[model samples]
Target chain A: MDALIEKLKGQIIEQLNLAEVKPEEINPDSPLFGEGLGLDSIDALELIVLLEKHYGIKIQDPKDGKTIFQSLRTMAEYIKSQGKS
Target chain B: MDTITSYAHIKHNQVSVNGEIIFQSYPSLSLPEFLSEAYKALGVSYPKFHKMDAQCKLGFLCTEFTLNGTSFLTENDITKTAIVLSNAASSLETDRVHQHSIDDKSNYFPSPAVFVYTLPNITIGELAIKHKITGENAFFVSEQFDAGLLVNYTETLIQSGTEASVMGWVEVDGTNFEAFIFLAEKQKYTNKNAIFKPLNKTSVITIYNQTIWTH
Candidate 1:
């Protein structure tokens, strides 16, 4: 789980073009949107692509995105639940 | 009288405002690096700048520099300001990237962020959002800079109630890029050192050549 969380940070940074952000700076338990990462709708869409492109995990429903992309930890857990982690 | 209060030119390995070079690196940096450097020199922080594609960046920087020269937007009714720009390649640079992503379903990963900028007019949208400009806007695709078209269109817009306008050419394809943005407004100018030029075809052509044809 720790390894997945760490890996997700790098993927998010590259996929979102967060060039100024570092891996250590992203808190796994913090929110990925709003005040946490300050990401917008575009970044959320990129995160969706990142999951499918890198982990082969497809988000079956749109509503699930709210909970799934809530944080780095939530994303890692979702991938694990899908057996893609 | 409508006058071009200030302008920004990007070419020959430098970025200039009102004909004065503000940023340039000898061993020309990569396009991304060059734009990042130019954004830094502008001394303003706008996080959305990083997410834009190359073409949008060119136009964004051009608008930033020209506005830096005068209080054109602040002094005039921002909602009455307009943006009229032209480019040769359009958004082909980002289109190529988007094409590659969807080239094959087996290896497909089309990014929504990248896809949003596929339209050349998105550069104008970026400018509008950044400057809160809600007035008229248009994006033209021409084989070369069409100063006559810009002048005619902008003049028509001004006659139709546009109080101010930022119009010119901004192009980006692969490593080649250029931007020449000028401000046109129905405001009195008293800057003693201003390069007083009316928004006419001859004057527009001369300003464009000052940087584009200098190479």
Candidate 2:
């Protein structure tokens, strides 16, 4: 679980090019959008692609991604539920 | 009085004015292809072009030809020159890609790589760096081409004793891109002796509004 969270954090940083951000700075349970990580709609699409490419999760609907990508904890739980991790 | 001796341009490697072609070269294959070819022709590294956004690349191409290999003025002379450019889209391509990221949830994250090009001023920044032009730089956006605004601003600079003003219109829509430039200087001449005439604001508004080039 810890390793998966680390991997996810790395991916977020790389995909977003969060220049000043480090992996350790992201809180696993913190919100990934708006308040916490401050990611917007565009970042959400990139994250969705990251899921599909890395974990074989296909997000066919944008609305469904809101719940799944709320935070690292939610994303990790979803990935585990899908037997992806 | 300062005077424009000559003007030159290269679109797809062909220097031209109006419909008259001064020099012609083969058209580029694609955006990437053109960038690569331009980099090679200028003897700059390929990676450098890759690092630059589209607008910067286009601005560089236009400005390089405008200078025509003239030795850039030293720091003391730098204050005498200025750059004034106009564009239609103003980084819409960057905006489009950024909007795409938001429209599609599957791509929930935006790449910072794409975000940096969102501003229209990056082109001017690129031009200043390449040409070492440190005087004045301004970028204006219009609904369509405004030759009068360009001419008037350049004339103002010339009249103020600026050595020269590099002014132009650069517009890109999808795959089509056009750049028109004039290197101007102030001169005392009657209407008949004036090689370049400044169009009145009303005439400019009409021409731009109607998309009429021939007066």
Summarize candidate 1's per-residue lDDT along A5-69 as a digit string, tens digits. 99999988888888778899999999999988899998988988999988887888989999999
True contacts kept of each: 0.63, 0.05
Could you tell me every candidate's TM-score relative to the true structure?
Answer: 0.93, 0.56
Q: Write the per-residue lDDT of candidate 1 for residues B109-146, one digit (tens) a residue.
A: 89999999999999999999998999999999999989
Candidate by candidate, in order, the iRMS in Å equals 1.1, 7.3
Model 1 residue A53 CA deviation (Å) reads 0.8
TM-score, candidate 2, first chain:
0.93
lDDT of 2 by residue, A1-85 (tens): 8888888999878776464578888999999988887876767777887887689898777788989998998998888889998
| lDDT at B202, model 1 | 90
Off by over 4 Å in 2: A1-85, B12-28, B45-47, B72-76, B159-161, B185-215
User: What overall lDDT goes with each candidate model?
Assistant: 0.87, 0.65
On TM-score, the leading prediction is 1
> Residue B100 lDDT in model 2?
83
DockQ of 1: 0.73
Pick by DockQ: which candidate is best?
A: 1
Worst 10 residues of 1 chain B by lDDT: B206-215
